[model samples]
Target chain A: MKQLKTRTEQILATMPILAWVAFAAYVIETGAVLYSYTISFVDPEAAKDVYRGLNLYRLSKINFWYYTQAISLIAGLAVSKAVVAWLVIRALTKFRLENPFTMDMVVRLEKISYAAFGTWVLAMVSNGHLAWMMKETGELQGNWISGEFIFIIALVYVMSQIFRRGVEIQTEHELTV
Target chain B: MPITVNLDVMMAKRKMSLSELSEKVDLTLANLSILKTGKAKAIRFSTLEAICRVLECQPGDLLEYDDGNKK
Candidate 1:
């Protein structure tokens, strides 16, 4: 039982790192695809003409694409952090709770997580342009429905709850130990 | 639920000081103090066992249930 517990802990500890690696790989692949599209398919002459007519920098065309990509990347990372935090917390809490770690700590942590999640949700929502860009870039290729927005809100909410519960369990363990 | 700890009694019986107990148990004096005071919310079995073994007593000797007033 002790060995099993240690092994499980080792795996859980590595989960966030693993998640980030997978996410990074996906982002790189997507960036490569977009880069190829812009370079190979977009007519440089047409872009230059448009830039000249609008008195914009010729480099601005490529720069805009890069800028938007950076924005999306940063935004995606923020959301992912919140999501991962929520997941890890939830998993750890559930594991400890079922192991009969401590109910008091788990309950208290969950309460805190609820508030944290609410704050995270608001922060994400406030950056509305990020989601809009995802839609503009064909990433969020669906209609801008209320359900979609709610889904984002729900995702953060659920994750926060998980983290809160986990914290409670950890606190309980600390106290007991 | 009210719980009580008897760390001082065990330490006294074992002829061990808090510093010695703290060193033997691989726990900080601060944490040992917390457990001794019954202010800690929980205790790990391993830690309890270590304390008991070092003190030459059972867990029951170190901990007791107090039900006069539940908090």
Candidate 2:
């Protein structure tokens, strides 16, 4: 018998495209961070107005070790976040609403949780560096503070646990006679 | 996992094929195969009743508790 999909599954079907869009945004963000870092060194004159008039190029020169370390941490966090976004896309691609609970989906969810955890760690490190820089350099942390990654990690970890149980239940149900 | 299925023995005694039993019980052949191979995690009472009715056997005849079956 064919079952009509609920509104949630219908939305789930559309979520993959949204996930891809998010992935693209993350890629763009990583590229922007790397570009800003490289431009600060390659063209000191141009770096003054790159980040919406932040003048991070001149900021780096104020104290090279502190500013550069904070910048590197920011870049690392961006790259790790992009990796997490890519993992989310992969998990969404493997998910099927018709058969939502499968070993493959469970494995993918676990992988996403792991990646998210790694990203969260990187976020914590970046946040610490940025916080210290804010104190010394008096520069605002702005959006560079990534404390939000902890929430993302918790969400994905809970989802993976639920999916693991779902896989077990589905297996038991299929084997029932 | 120690609960063992004796469906094959019961079917042989009743001179019934897996397909015949599946048809009489209105269950899919794959489901019947799963039960016969002892891979089934559970059996519904209605399903056991239907299978017993088709094979002319008791639930005890179709299933057995085996101590040696650790898995």
- How do the candidates score on chain B by TM-score? 0.89, 0.92
Task: Give one digit per residue, the lDDT tens place, for model 1 in B1-71.
Answer: 47788999878887899999999989999889888877788888899988988888998998888888757
Task: Report the CAPRI category for model 2.
Answer: high
Error of 1 at A69 (Å): 34
Worst 10 residues of 1 chain A by lDDT: A48-57
Candidate 2 runs further than 4 Å off: A1-6, A50-53, A145-149, B69-71
Write candidate 1's Cα lDDT for A94-142 as tens digits: 5542444455444544454554455455445534644665555533221
lDDT of each: 0.58, 0.77
Q: Which residue pairs in model 1 clash with each other?
A: A90-A162, A105-A168, A106-A168, A109-A164, A176-B42, A176-B43, A176-B44
User: In model 2, what is the error at residue A46, expressed in angstroms?
Assistant: 3.7
Q: Which residue runs does candidate 1 get wrong by more than 4 Å?
A: A1-145, B13-15, B69-71
